[model samples]
Target: MSRPRSYDEPSVLSGAMQAFRRDGYRGVSIRDLEDATGLKAGSIYNSFGDKAGLFDAAFEHYNKVVLGGRVDRFAPAAAGISGLRDLFISLMHEPNGESHGCLITNSAIELDRDEQTYRHVCTGMDILFEVFLNRLAAAQQDGSLRAGTDPVLAATKLLALYQGLLVLVRAGRDTQALERLVAAEFHELETYHDARPAQQDIQA
Candidate 1:
C-alpha cells in the first residue's frame, strides 16, 4: 500500500490560496508555492501531480471553505437583507485589513477565456449569485423586500454590485465610500416599506 501523507491538506491549500490571491496564478512559481505551503518540491509534486493540480485544489478549497464560510457567517437564509448588507460590509474588513483580493476575481482578470481557471471562476461567481438569489427570494416571501421588486432582477444586481465592490476594495479605493454606497443600496431595498401605511392605518 502507498504511504499516508503527513501534511495537513487544508493547511496546505490555505497557504496555496494565500499565495495565489497575493499573486495571480501566472505570477506564482513552484518555489513560491513551496515556501507558502511548507512542502518540499518532491512532496508537492507527489501530493499534487503538478503546479496546475495544486492550484486547482487550492481554488476549490477557496470556493468551498473560505467563500462558503463567509456566506454562512454573514448571509444565511434566515438573515435576509440584513445578512446581505452585513456580507457586503464584511468585504471591507478582510483579515488584517489587507486585501489579498478574492481568488475568483483575481483569476477572472488574470486568466484568459479559454483557460481551465475560467470555469472555476464561473463556479465561484455562480455560488455567490445563487446565494444572493436565494436570500432575496426568501426576503420577498417574508415581505421584507421592496414593493414590486423582482427577486431575480434584484439578485442579479446584487451579484454585480458584490463583484464590483470586491474589485474596488482590491484596488484600495475609499472603503468608507464603498460602505456608504452599500448602505444606500440596501436602504433603497427597505425604503418602500417605510412609506407604506401599516395594517391599522390602512383600516382607519
Candidate 2:
C-alpha cells in the first residue's frame, strides 16, 4: 500500500511559497523546493503535478493569505478606498518585512504571459483592481472625490502605485518613505464636499 502523506499540505505550500517569493521560478529548481519545503522530489510531484502546479498553488496562497487578508472590511463602496490604503499600511509592516516583495507582482514580471503561473498572477492583480475600482466609485458617489473623476482610471492609477511600491520594497526602499508619499497623494484629494459650503454661499 502507498505510504500516507507525512506533512501538512498547507504548511508545505507556505514554505514553498517563501522560496518562490525569494527566488523567481526560473531561479529555483526541484532541489530548491525540496530544501524549502523539507519534502522529497517524489512527494512534491505527487502532491502538486510539477513545478508549475506547485507554483500555481503557492501563488494562490499568497493571494488569499497575504493580499486578501483584512480586505473584507473595505468591501462596501466608500469603505473600499480606505481598504486600499489600509492594505498598503499593512503591507509595509508585514511580518518578515525585508527584501521579499509581492509574490504576484514578482511573478507577473518574471513568468511568461503564456505560462500557467501567469493566470494566477493576473487573477490576483484583477482582485486588487476590482477592490480599488469599487472604492473609487463609492468615493465619487459620497462626494469624497471631485466630480468628473473616472473611478476606473483612478483605480488603475492606485493599482500602479501599489505595484510600484512592491518593486520599491524589493529594491530596499524605506517603508517610511512610501508612507509619506502615499499620505501626500491622499492629502491632495479635492473632496467635493470640501467646496460645498462655499458654493451654497455663492448661490445665496
Candidate 3:
C-alpha cells in the first residue's frame, strides 16, 4: 500500500504542465520538475513512479484544463463561426504576451513517430478538431455556414491552420501577420455565411 498524497494535485499539475509546455518532455529534468512542482525527487518518484508518469499526468492536465478551457471560453458550440474566429485570434494574443507554444503542437513535432507520446498529442488535437466540427455543424444548422459546406473538411482545415499558426508563433513570427491570416481565412468563411441565410430564404 502507498501513502496518500498531501500536496495540492491541481496546483502541482499546473506547474508541471507549464514546465512541459516551456520545455519538451525530454528537455524537462527531474530536478526541473522538483523546482516546478515544489516536490522533492523522492516524493515525485513515490507519487508518480517516474518522470514519464509525471509528464503523462501533466499532459493530460493540459488537455483537460488549459486546452478545454480555452475552447469553452472562445469557441463554444453556440458561438459558431464567429466564435471560432475569436478562438484563432485568441491564440495570437497569449496572456502577458507569453508564447511558450502550444503543448500539443510542440509535442507532435518533438515526439513524432513515438506512439506513446503521440497518444496525448492526438487526444489534444482531437479535442480541437471535434470543437471545430461541432461548431461548424451548429453554424450550418443555424444557416450561418455556407450551404453545402462540409463540416468535417472545414474542421480539418481549421485544425491544420491552427497547428501551423502555433508553429509560426513559436518561431517568433509577427503577431500582426498571424492575426491577419486568421482574419482572412475566417473572412472567406464569413463571406459564404452571409449568402447562406439568403439562399435559405430563396429555397423556402
User: Candidate 1, residues 5-86: lDDT per residue as tens digits?
Assistant: 9899999999999999988898999999999999998999998999989999999999999999999999998898999999
TM-score of each model, in listed order: 0.91, 0.83, 0.89
Candidate with the larger TM-score of 2 and 3: 3
List model 3 lDDT by residue over 78-197, tens digit each.
788999999999888887767767889998988866657579999998899999998888887888887777889999999999999998888889989999999998887655645346
Which ten contiguous residues of candidate 3 have the minimum total lDDT? 190-199
Assess each prediction's global lDDT (C-alpha) against the native. Answer: 0.90, 0.79, 0.88
Q: Arrange candidates by TM-score, descending.
A: 1, 3, 2
Please estimate how well model 1 matches the true structure, expressed as its whole-model Cα lDDT.
0.90
What TM-score does candidate 2 get on C-alpha atoms?
0.83
Assess candidate 2 and give its lDDT. Answer: 0.79
C-alpha-based local distance difference test score of model 3 = 0.88
